[model samples]
Target: MSEPKSLEGVFHLVHMIKRHMHEQIEQLDLNISPMHMRVLKIINKQQTCTAVDIAQLLNRDKAQVTRLLNELIKQTLIEKVPNPEDKRSQRLLVTSEGMEVLAHLTTIDGNMNNKMMKGISREELKEFERITGLMTENLARAD
Candidate 1:
């Protein structure tokens, strides 16, 4: 029989995409990791949320999100405001600096996508998104 093909290539692709994006950010001398960017994006989307909410939204552990949020705060990318309803949990506030950097990263993200998928058509992109979503669901089920 011929060599068997596997979905391992998809895993490799995911790893490389992450590595490449990190390199791209490093080139910009931002000193922020991809996960840092992810956390910022999450906070920006939610506007005023807690670390717990962020962890739940990203499906990450609270400890991990707390660490990331700490770094973001140190970088002045996010601020913690008192949660009126719950004094125990503070709400995250995205700073203007954070929004500015996120906007820049968004541009980098778009350029990366365009460069990586130069020839892919709209239909192909849509199909890829659908398949990837299904794959994510399948992985979650397996877990």
Candidate 2:
């Protein structure tokens, strides 16, 4: 049988990784969805993140991002503080609890990546990253 095309292989790999991550997260029983975790991570990473910023980053609608933010707030994982520059907008901040959860999620990602790259050498991984970076640049140029 012929090997799968690069795009097809990449798509399949992404699907499997997402599925595995979802499974691992489900085992935590934290009552948080993957998207919620994503928002939390983004909030944790950004110094002054707004709901609109998250919407743009995730390529999701504002309403959807707002819903996710609301859920995170309800869970006490994140809080909103007044944006000094914009009175109308608030900046999202990950709470201490959110940091703990984020750390766990990071661990999960690290473990998954380690497993995925088990047999790959450092050079091979570096080259893979280089190729993917070029691919990302190519796609960006198409936009």
Candidate 3:
């Protein structure tokens, strides 16, 4: 493929992957967007998460992160507890319910990965990852 076609193919693959994931999430009837799921995963991974931390990590605005956090709180998937070291800020924690959702999401992700890699060899998958990593770094440097 030509350079332009290769870029277009990458974009198309990303769109398809996101659309498929969204459809899967919708089937869960969890009433959460992919972005919300991402926030939950980040909170689960981080030791002490906060709105600011999520915003920075997601490269999104504070307002957007706040909305996501509020939705997650309302869903009872996450909670805010007082920060022991910082009286001014509260830390975010994924609730037990959120952990369950994360487990489901993990299964969905594994299935998707397996489907995507069905015909690809391990060596080819490793090369794809390396190439994608380089492409991501290239884009970052463009900023």
Candidate 4:
């Protein structure tokens, strides 16, 4: 296999990681798809998250975020409570069941992180994260 050293390599790595993560998510009996599970995580992190907030965080369109939120609601993984600050918007939160799933996903995430970073040092990882962040900002600005 060719060593990945460019932006294409970074994207390839992301795709491979996503594939394995999706497989791991599929092994759970929670009935939520990997996308829905990810939405749950966003809601869990931001108790007052709006669909717009989630859309921005995910770099997805508002319509797509709404679709994912709808699925999460149908599966009882997340709930949309009335936004006290804005009558037109609803705040998203993860349900008790979703929290449980998050806990399980946390373990899965840790395992994946460990395996993916086996030989990489902490400093290298930090530098990688910094570069990725810069790249993300560049893309965001281009959009």
Winning model by TM-score: 3
Regions of candidate 1 where Cα sits further than 4 Å from its true position = 1-6
Q: Could you tell me which residue pairs clash in candidate 4?
A: none
lDDT of 2: 0.89
Give per-residue CA lDDT, model 4, range 1-143, as digits (tens). Answer: 35356767888998988887887877766576677767878788775799999899888998898888888888787888899999999998888888889998998789889989999999999999998899778877994
TM-score per candidate: 0.89, 0.88, 0.93, 0.87
TM-score-wise, the better of 1 and 3 is 3
Q: lDDT by residue for model 1 over 1-49, one digit each (tens)?
A: 2223337767687798898888888877787988898889888888568
| Deviation from native of the Cα of residue 129 in model 1, angstroms | 1.2
**lDDT (Cα, tens digit) per residue for candidate 2, span 14-112:** 898989888888887667877888888888888889999999999899888888999899999999999998999999999998988998899888989
* Model 4 vs. true fold: TM: 0.87
lDDT (Cα, tens digit) per residue for candidate 3, span 1-143: 69899899999999988888898888887788889889999999999988889999999999988889999999999999999978998999999999999998998788889888999999999999999999889988995
Q: On a 0 to 100 scale, what is the lDDT of residue 100 in model 2?
A: 86
Candidate 1: pairs in clash: none
Q: In terms of lDDT, which candidate is strongest?
A: 3
Q: Which ten residues in a row have the lowest lDDT in candidate 1?
A: 1-10
Worst 10 residues of 4 by lDDT: 1-10
User: Alpha carbon lDDT of residue 69, candidate 4?
Assistant: 88
The global C-alpha lDDT for each of the candidates, from Candidate 1 onward, is: 0.86, 0.89, 0.91, 0.84
RMSD of 3: 1.3
Displacement of residue 64 (Cα, Å) in model 3 is 0.7
Question: What is the RMSD of candidate 2?
Answer: 2.2
Error of 3 at 62 (Å): 0.6
